[model samples]
Target: MQDAIYAPHWNRNAHSVICVLRGRAQVQVVDDFGQTVFDDELQQEQILTVPQNFAVVKRASNEGFEWVDFKTNDRAQISPLAGRTSALRAIPADVLANAFQLRQEDVSELKVNMERQGNTLLRPSRSSSQWRAIA
Candidate 1:
């Protein structure tokens, strides 16, 4: 596991089994309707199965975490909900702005931030605080 939270994402072609090897983790999986499907803390030697295409996020405990993930497909395509790999970036700015109910300028600013961060496994520091708030 990584120290930073792995932002919600899904693998189009794979299901995954994660075995905790060290420390602990908080795992959450959600359905298409954004309903929580699973939420729990996993400690060393525990395992969790993530069904194919289910949106999931994993956050390491304060002591940090490590896990071995086995995926059904060797070549899984991950679509992130935030950050550089987010599928939202592929949408037209005007369409995205309308869908998100945000001003075009705000959408542009979001795009700029996304581009600047590049592909990161973890959400940025600013967003991480929001996660903590929810936790």
Candidate 2:
């Protein structure tokens, strides 16, 4: 119904990977014991991942800026952005505009299930004798 707001605190389940389309987004990451570690701006076509259990902050670079925010089931307190750190900013409800927003379910379903080389879905390693030596 309304433009989406970036979560204020760190998310436990929703790992975030932000990709800017027409605008920009500032991704803020806080380290363990609650210290700001990452604060950077991502422009169009750039990709970044926020690992689980890390404090993250996202905000549009300018008014009407559009970007896609990927979220998972993990959730953080949905509150007005509150912090004095240079990396985080509280976006007023009016200026937060975007073309599309992906909810947790949408992101969860779209996740890539990459299997390792020797998992159940992959062939197990065979004995060295089974392989012909490279001649």
Who wins the lDDT comparison?
1
- Residues 31-68, candidate 1: write the lDDT tens digits: 77778999999899998888888898888887888888
lDDT of 1: 0.77
Q: Considering every candidate listed, which one attains the maximal TM-score?
A: 1
Residues 7-92 of candidate 2: C-alpha lDDT, one tens digit per residue: 44554556767667766666678865677778887667887776666766665554434566687654532222233321223332
Q: Which lDDT value does model 2 have at 34?
A: 72
TM-score of 1: 0.73
- Per-prediction backbone clash count: 1, 2
Error of 2 at 109 (Å): 40
Candidate 1's C-alpha runs over 4 A off are: 1-3, 90-110, 123-135
TM-score of each: 0.73, 0.44
Whole-model lDDT per candidate:
0.77, 0.46
